[model samples]
Target: MRRQRPIRLQHGTSLHAIVLATAMTFSGASALQAREAGSAETSDTQVRLPENAEIQLAPVLVEGQERSAGQYTATVFTGAEIEDLGLFNSEDVLRMTPGVNINSSGGTNLSSVFIRGVGSMYLSDVTDFMVPMVIDGAPINARHISLGTLDVDRMEILKGPQGTLSGPWGLAGAVDITTRKPTRTFEGYGRAEYGEQGQALLEAAIGGPLTDTLSGRLAVRYSQSEHWVTNDADGAPMANPSNFALRGQIFWDGKQGTTALVTVEHEDVNALPNLLVLMPYGRKPSVDLTPGLYDDVGKSLNRYALEVNHDLASSRITSISSYMNASNMEIAAYDRKIMQAQSGYPSEFWNQDNGRESFFTQDLRLSSLPGDTITWAAGLFFQHMDASYDTPRNTYGYTSPRFRDFKSNVYAIYGDVTYPVTSALRLTLGLRQNWSSTDYDASFWRGGVGSFDSRAMSESATTGRAMLSYDLTPGTVLHARYARGFAPGGYNMYAAQIADGEPFGGATNDMIEIGFASESEDKTFALTGAAYVNWVSNNHLLAYDSGTYVSSVVNADTRSQGFELQGRWRVGGGLELAAGLSYVDARITSSVFGPSDGDILSGNLVPDVSPWSALVSASYETALPPFLGLSSPMLKSIASYSYVGPRPANPQNSLDLAAYHKLDIHVGVAQDKTEIYVRASNLLDDMYDLYGYAVPAANMAYGGMARGRTFVAGISHRF
Candidate 1:
């Protein structure tokens, strides 16, 4: 079907300016309040309110803690806050997190998450360079981490090296998501929504008692959307995406000290590849070209997990076991007609990639109960994964087929201890030892002949952390820490093009950081800030060799330093405000494959590393007067703005991405058991590039475009 052009809304420029100015003004007011409150010396007991008039706020927890008083440098978002922001998926949630960036080439399943300018530059069945993602205590693959957050209880983003606690694959950071558990009371909610471009959504969840000692919960969601882009060649829709997911969970509270929980989930996704528009000399095209063909890419996943906990006299023991299976298939036009348009190629080529992967993991931990002077935890972890990829291509009467198989095993032991040296001072120490091995096998067939080769490699590393924290005053704390992280290396599947039995070496990072956190006596204002410097040795870098149509992984040295600030304020009346700002300086210190062998590229900005980013948001809620013989209803509205600075697109720092800004707004009304809302995103309908890659041989370049203005309306009911 032909897609219609979006209507450009007016008054966006004025609204944007107003939002920025208002945020700045409120920020200044909050800072002044902080200063006034800090002038007087007060005991920590003075911050507590009277028992009768005390107001309870949502608790701040990070991945299983009752509160995040002084554990680590992190950010926590509750489910209610996520819903208020209208962020229902992983992509949107990560984009709003501080110091994080996400880029999707063409499909949500093919997205990459970068933290502190560290992530994989290419996607493959055997690559594991991105930030690790954990859902319900089970680790998930990077390609399959775009699951919906509809039923999440809380999300915790731990910044910097977490190797000692999360094992490998956390060299940059880690994201842990906890799903809502079954409730003892009977309750459920259902919602439906309609939006532009033929978008429709349906979601429902229910949880209640099934038996005396057993409770169960089930949730399902489905969504479909028409293409937002138009194809000029045939005047048809360019891309359409849809997905369905279902989850079931059961909980058993057995004896006094025993508890168990089990969960199973399945998800399926089908979508068209991202729209690719050719650009020459970094200029947008007046008109988009037509693709020679179109095909759908599909992915399916199944996951299962079991967790058990037993309380001892002075400690608790826990165990977690998980399994996952996933498959993906794609068939599409490889050239997208860019070759024909720019290089006069006779015809476009076709390509296919079919792959599958399986994962098994187990973790055991024992932790001492809370103590007056000391607390400690120790754990053992194990994981095994296998993956296979097959690729077939036909270009101008030449056919080539390739296949690769990969297997990996990981083992680790870690421990951490915290002790209070004084009433206001605390110290912590942690260490981890990891051992990993990988085996890779590949084969290629051409002219009715094939050859095969196999290679294996193993590595070991020890990483640790040391920290000190002190309370400056009531509701204020200052901390400093030193940490180390590691990421295991592996072989490139395209063994035919590289040296025999050669593999990339593991990478390591060392960091030193200082930070502070403070909250107002009334809990109406909060602020957290951090500054850190990191040096990485043997940094893994992916480079494309245009001459050979192959990609290679290499090691180099790099450095990154940055500071981040986040704040929240609850002004008088019904107004609330939040804001975040980050600045980073990341560069390559040395590399061997530069303009010449052993050339130094010191001071060159790293690819995809934005130097500056900021976010500001406001929300208001109040009761409305009675109308139409109905009781008072509540009205709520929220607005948010985000800015991302420009960055280098390649290693040479030749091509650059332009800075961009986005705005989102939501308004709703609620009465008793019913609620209605309307949401608008990208209010300005701004057009910008999310990512760009060059095809030098075809004298062409293509990129992914940011989404334009979109609107949605929805209503829901609760019992």
Candidate 2:
């Protein structure tokens, strides 16, 4: 039987130092854009901005909010930037952020996210519910919510363990997705794109005020692309499928500073399944290489939110309440030839899994800027989440039909206050006290036999954050911080039926960081750097059993330490240079046990950790001298290389997945209302895999599929 261990916690370990070092170094660097939450302003630093006056404020868009930007190490990508890259999904947009790991299962509908190498218990495309997807202050907690890059004002990737703020699985981090809200003025934008490999995309968004207090916006996106890999067995290329999404929202700006917004969205996908990331195994056909196989997935999302705020004698009170429901269904298969067993019909080799998740959150915050030396915000929050999954045996009958359900309801009150201890030194303190309950149910069915009983578990925690900051000068600041985070533990559907006993484990993480950021607000250059160490006790990790290829969830002591640096500099006329580097050290500090008793994994590098990574980009865009067909202005550009370092495949830390490097170039022409652009990614066509794995005695087979050389042509129109 699996033993349950008490939650473990530590401090100032390897991962914490590494992350702190990186955050400090890049905090002032121009390479990363500061995330703007609420409304804050910062000094302007001109570096590598296009001379087109129209593109005058890229830096301002990134670093416009000085106070908010200085308080947290966050990154932001604007809508204009996403459109310019011709990205098909939000994953494409997130992959560029520092310390972020995004892997997709070859289709638009399935994607996985990892931050700072933390919790990674995901098996298929369904990731752990650690990161909350918030749109316009409404939390989205469903896998079916198609996160396409459409009608977005900006996206903020808040790093570090976010336990103190967002409870439950938010022990890892948070991703705030803010969509384009209705504007007071009539305005809208539309874009269309076509590219190699049979790729097509169309997007449109429009919004305007209907009355003094009412306004609305609607967005639609449709995309399709051909598969990049060709089946070696059937001499056929896996077909790229199609996906679509639609969203509509309306807002009411009530008199006396109150507002409410309602939103609804739906998305669908039809395509082939993901190619299983097998380690080095030769002469084996990929899942996509097989014939008579298909993956069909669908999603539905319904969300409603209401927000209200009022200014009283001494404080501002705000309330935001929302409800969301999401569902996902997938039918897929693995390597049939390799997985065949029993009757050899591959009956038990398939998976039919369905999931339903629902969540509701209500938050109330009160803030006051009583004096120049003191600024504070406090809030009370209540949330409820429920998720259930169903899985059935394949023809092989190696597994039984299984069912699992989980429910959680929580209440929390937290506050953060910043006090100026002196003219140059500031201290910030935050705390969140939470109370919650959890319940789990699991059972199995075999050959007209149903057996097993359900178990219920409950627990609660209080998490918090504390930090200090000091300004050495107007252009530089130094800070130190410590934080605690948490992840809810419950039933594992796959384990409940397969293992001798269902063991559900919870995890806790503690981190410490220190850093400095210095930039000349009026100059053409800036730099930011940080280092951190993080220690995780009962760190939940996913491991594969040796004999059967079946995977299980385990909790092991783990550590990750890393550092990062980013810089941006302007090189005279129309030339800009941006660069970044990251180093992470993640490894297992202890072993995990399966129901069978012996060690399942003694020492393994956790999955999805890229130890060394860097990106270097230099571009020069020149304004055409009013040439032929150029009505308003145009910019032509070429850029250098971007690099992603090797990642380890297994826990023993023996395999080294090859690194990747690619070059790109771009050119654009713009009129008053219309813009046209062309971009080439992977111009050099370097053959490298993003990840690789090893098969027992089958030789090392890597899973890096080259995107090859591709061209994207796109046009955007503004009214």
Candidate 3:
């Protein structure tokens, strides 16, 4: 067994300072409570009506607002539910979504979201098969998805290919995040929290009408935390993460049922990747390599968007235009040794990469108003992306200094329609055609020799969807759907040594699914289930060639079949339970990058995919009995458990990770405009690995561990 060291804050910062700061911020805001009291209060009024006046209440809807009768599978999380779950970042929220898995190599921005066994672990700027992330109708890079979740109104996860509606990058699926909009009434909230591991958080948001026909909203968040591990080699904190975000929006309502909104957001983050430990299943080791090597990542993003909507007699027109600028810098030790052997240098070798990306997108769509017989929508999409990067070497000169640039343009047109054949049955169809072009340029120096390369590629594909749905009962529906989706192919900048004109080919998937959803009367219980088979052709797989020390993309065939079950039951008396289960059997059926003709990978499990996963949660909420003369104080308690089964770590299934389970609990009390809560994550302090990587040259396998037990206490005030 390896000896472990006590983890301590390196800067000698006291937790007392954090507590005092939180106390002061909350105390200072108390002065504004009096001014906000009147606006925050709820009142009821009654008035006498005319002799013949009549009033009726509207019907109550219990389902999620973002959900619709559709061919695809999706899950929606409301803002309130997000808050209740204590999710502070996109990574935390994504882990709770059904049929989804997340893996990170240590930093907040170095992460990937796998939807139903389809995702890329390589750098996003170089890969085409990525789970698209959309915020307020604007597409963003995957690296920016880890920004703190502030003032988000809702989040929707669309499963499977969303090509027809979400465009080219939605090859796996899409994550749609809607931020809070300006409200007609003045409302705001402020929060302060202190937690274990030197974690502190502050968040606030305000929204209201600025004028008769204009509204505005603003939100801000800041957080900081020390790393969970210690760098024993240097006696320094392994990972320190800090981030801040700000967002503002304005909405204008014009005459003739026309409305427009403009939004701007900015975020900055700095962090160190998680400390990787040699793995074969044992106690956390005291790593003794890579001393005094720069290991940090920094990222920043700025986004702006404008959306307009106009209502016609029986139709609506919508337009969205967005722009994003993102920049990032990373410095890390590529290889670490206990002592220099032959090389007259330190034990650690360092390298750095800096890059920038700019994106612009425009979408135009028209939709007819809902009708008893038919409803339809048609849209056009155009997007342009430009990315550039520079890599400089400081030690371990295995690769030469390189500079690369990539530019891409995508144009698409799509339409969707649904027609009711009878009162109990419906038919739906969707079609999309997309054309894309990419240009790449690179320059590198190898062994005192310089070389330059440039290439251009073009690709196009047409995808479609068909579905049939029928009502089995008043509150139950069954549906079956078939869909096809594709991802564009591009050149790999790091693989410039490869033969010319041998760029990777595009990938496509055809899927068939059958599902059903039902809810009991009074909304006490609800259930949804789906089974799907996805056959993917020319699937993109990343491979590292030791001979060249370069990573390249290859074409392969894969099959992913899975079944999902989700249910929620209200046990009455303010006690509720929810559970979700998924079984995914994803495997590679054929591969072109085999070691030998007789050793082809024809039935190997897909990497980073778990065969089984599950989540169970329970919550109880009730009114407290006159606590200190407080009126109608509410108390709530919640507990949740999640499991991730074993999974392969590499494409060849050479390494495996064992199963792991996690537990979280939360308790809170609220009265009037104030609330306080305590949350505990990984209560049992379970030790498990979320992901692993094998370095054949070093004869070592590195694993990323799940965070240990943590506790946090927070206070919030609403006005």
Clash count for each candidate, listed in order shown: 0, 52, 2
Q: Provide TM-scores for the models.
A: 0.88, 0.85, 0.86
- Window of ten residues with lowest summed lDDT in model 1: 31-40
Best by TM-score: 1
Q: Which is the better candidate, 1 or 2, if ranked by lDDT?
A: 1
Tell me the alpha-carbon RMSD of every candidate: 6.8, 6.9, 9.3
Candidate 1, 1-719: lDDT as tens digits: 12112112111234556466455324321111121110012123111212321111111221111111235576566665565455667676777665776666555455666677666554433647446777777777566555677677667676777755433337777676778888788877788889997778898889988998888999888888866656556666665678798999999988688889999998877764544555531222222333424445778888999988888998778788999888877653434455556557634454566678898999887876544246666889998989887675545333568778889998999987777888888788888998999998887777878877788889999988888888888677888889888878887654333242268788788888888878777777777788988888877665555334455566777788898888876674566666778888888887554421122255667666788977676666566888765585766566667777777655545456666677677677777666788878776565555566554444345556656778999887765
TM-score of 3: 0.86
Candidate 1 local lDDT, residue 717: 70
Position 527, candidate 2: lDDT? 71
Ranking by lDDT: 3, 1, 2
Error of 1 at 217 (Å): 1.1
Q: Over the stretch 1-719, how does candidate 2's per-residue lDDT look in tens digits?
A: 33222111111124443344343323321223444343223334434354353432121123221343234555566665556545455665555666666544443334445566665545321224455566666565323223576777677766566533322226656666777888788888888889998878888988899898999889998898766665545766545567777888788888766667777766666664455533332323344334544545555556677766676777777777888776666544545433442123432245666677788888888776334346677888888888777775554553567777777777888877777788888877777776666676767777767776666666566677788888878878787888777665555544435352355466677878777767776656667777877777777665554334455566777887887776667665666566767777777788765422134354456656777766555545555667676656756343434555666544434455555555555556766567677877666554445343334333333343446668989887887
What is the C-alpha local distance difference test score of each model? 0.66, 0.59, 0.67
Task: Give me the runs in candidate 1 sitting further than 4 Å from their true place.
Answer: 1-70, 124-129, 166-169, 280-295, 331-337, 340-342, 370-373, 394-398, 493-502, 546-549, 594-600, 695-700
